[model samples]
Target: MTVVGKFLPLLGWVLAGVLMAEPASCESWVDLNVGSELQRPNEQTVVDQTALVRLNTRYSAPVGITLNAHYGLAHRVRLVDEPGTGIAAAQSTGADLRLWDLPTELWRSDGDTWVIEQNLDTLHGVFYWGAQEFTVGRQPISLGVSRQFSPLDVVVPQRIGAQERSYRPGVDAVRWRNPLGLTGELDVGWVFGQDNLLFARATQQWGTVSAEFTALTLNQAQWIVGLSTQTFAGDWGLWQESAWLHDDVLSGARITLGADRSVWSDVYVVAEYHYNDVGDAENMTSDFFQKGLVTLGKQHYVALNASATPSPLVNLNLGLLHNIQDADTLLLGNVGRSLGNNTQVDATIEVPLAKQDSGTEFAQIPLRLAVLWSTVF
Candidate 1:
């Protein structure tokens, strides 16, 4: 069937929601963020800045609709991107996966030392029909159970060094959810961006543990079978997510096992171990940029993270990533404090423990310092 034929049914439900929505029952809000980053490599330094806005509205009903839109403008000076990789390229796929991207960059400039661009990042809605739910337009569809790395997150994969955690870049797509009893649900989705993607997940809650099974195909070029589970034991929580990827681009098994616990009222810690057999350990390839393989040129990795809330308004987080094959490590840190009830500021930094010419994962990545301020109104 043609694309429109598939969406005709979803549009019917959207029309139903439009006729049933009451204006007085609508809820709306806005959020803004401004950030500046300093990226220093062994060779040069680059400055990146951005301002982002999110406007959200929701109408309450059995068949509800939510409209969330994001607008962002980015300015970057001094281009020192690694070969075949850049932040703009990683996020270009945001929007709908089964159709097209919503990030319609209104205008952009590219130069040897500077770049400027703006776009609409997110625009999507949700509606329900009896026990079934449908989401359409542009939205973030994140899937994973791992804390540090998730091999099964093929929908909207997160960047390893990305500082923004508040938003999962939106993509264009349509999704459906059907409840299976009280503890289980079946999810199915389609995204068409650079390529067509179709995926599904069936989840079930067994006692205190939740487990999910997943399958996805990307433009007939790739196929993946995945599994994930989450459970807690006493004060310690544990989870695992794994996937077996098969494709002409790359094929192999990837997995991560993780555990976390609160050591005290103010501190929490987590440790995770990841391994993959398909990644090329000898070369710093753009596999992540081109093929969405986040193994990062290594077969084994260890991640440790901790968070502390010393006061009501102050918070700190630290993360350590070790690439086993390359013997290089990277440390990520963030400190934040509230300026008021509706405003906050955060400072983040990344330090690599290896020389930039060492051909290691962290070695090639530059040291980064960023400051971000956000407010809600």
Candidate 2:
């Protein structure tokens, strides 16, 4: 049996115990999401279409405990208009799969063109007491100050140009957080398994500025230290994060600086710059996908994002990413509207700009259009 199958019965027993033992109030909710995407490559003769459905549930008890879980189903179809235009692509684009690393294939056929996958995105428990909190099981952990690019967020880092509706994958860990004072706190966590991934962070706030320092140990041999800070300058917000890794194999520093400002009441713009000393500028595509040393593979990058809400129920977003060394660019846009109190619809497009050669980074990505619908009950 699969890991999820073995754990389901145990989870059911625990939920029953919680419901029977607690005399306090209990709350539950469910969410349903459906998404479709189409891709057209520049020189390819085939078009690809993908469909996905996901269900998520959450339960909270008055005893200061909560449970959450998610399940997903997806299908992909390829149309071959020309025989020579069909090419296989990579299964995943990013490399942040440290936690909950399970095999995703439930069933596959037709030369792997048709596939079925099941994922358990989140399955965690939380307990609270006074100013202290404890959490265990599979959960998401993110650390950093920058919004677009975070150099300090090494664990389960965000992927660039991925679908916005997809949730961050959870990792199995035990974590603790405690309040130091009115404006200070401390967080500590240890990810399970053989890698010995342990981390601690301290944060403090003063007036309109906040700062954090973190230390991480990997496999009991390598260490990484990070610092991040955020502050307001007049009407604009500014932040920076930096991290240095000490390891025998690869040792370097990564830094990110970002700023954002509101243009009007409903519009805002953001810009960010990132630098990674461990990245390669000459062979970006191979370095990023094969070696997994850096997220972008380029030593220097610049990113810009803007969002506007013309009405209460509609929003528009635009994003641009440029590789300074390779001169490749990625452009993204999205439009979303609220259908009612419980439903929303969104449309998005992604286009990559690069040379025709396969060696270029962005050129390998096909032009993509996606639509998503979600409802909550």
Error of 2 at 141 (Å): 1.2
lDDT by residue for model 2 over 1-377, one digit each (tens)?
Answer: 65544875897798679867876554555666666666767665455556566666666778788767666666555644455443353254433434445567666655555556666667777878877998877788787777767776656567776646235667777899999799999999987642446899999999998999999865655667999999989989999999886665567788999999999788999999999786765544442223232566667889999999999999999999887888889898999999999899999998988755757666677787878888887
Measured on C-alpha atoms, candidate 2 has an lDDT of 0.73
lDDT on C-alpha atoms for all candidate structures: 0.75, 0.73
Clashes of each: 10, 0
In angstroms, the error of model 2 at 125 is 0.7
TM-score of each: 0.85, 0.85
Write the residue-wise lDDT of candidate 1 on 43-129 in tens digits. 666676766666666555543555555656655544345543344432444223535433544444553344455656676667777
What is the Cα-based lDDT of residue 122 in candidate 1?
Answer: 70
**TM match of model 1 to true structure:** 0.85
Q: After superposition, how far is residue 121 of candidate 1 from its true place, in Å?
A: 2.1
Name the regions of candidate 1 deviating beyond 4 angstroms.
Answer: 5-17, 20-24, 59-63, 74-98, 101-116, 248-250, 281-289, 293-295
Sum up the clashes in candidate 1.
10
Question: In candidate 1, what residue range of length 10 has the lowest lDDT sum?
Answer: 87-96
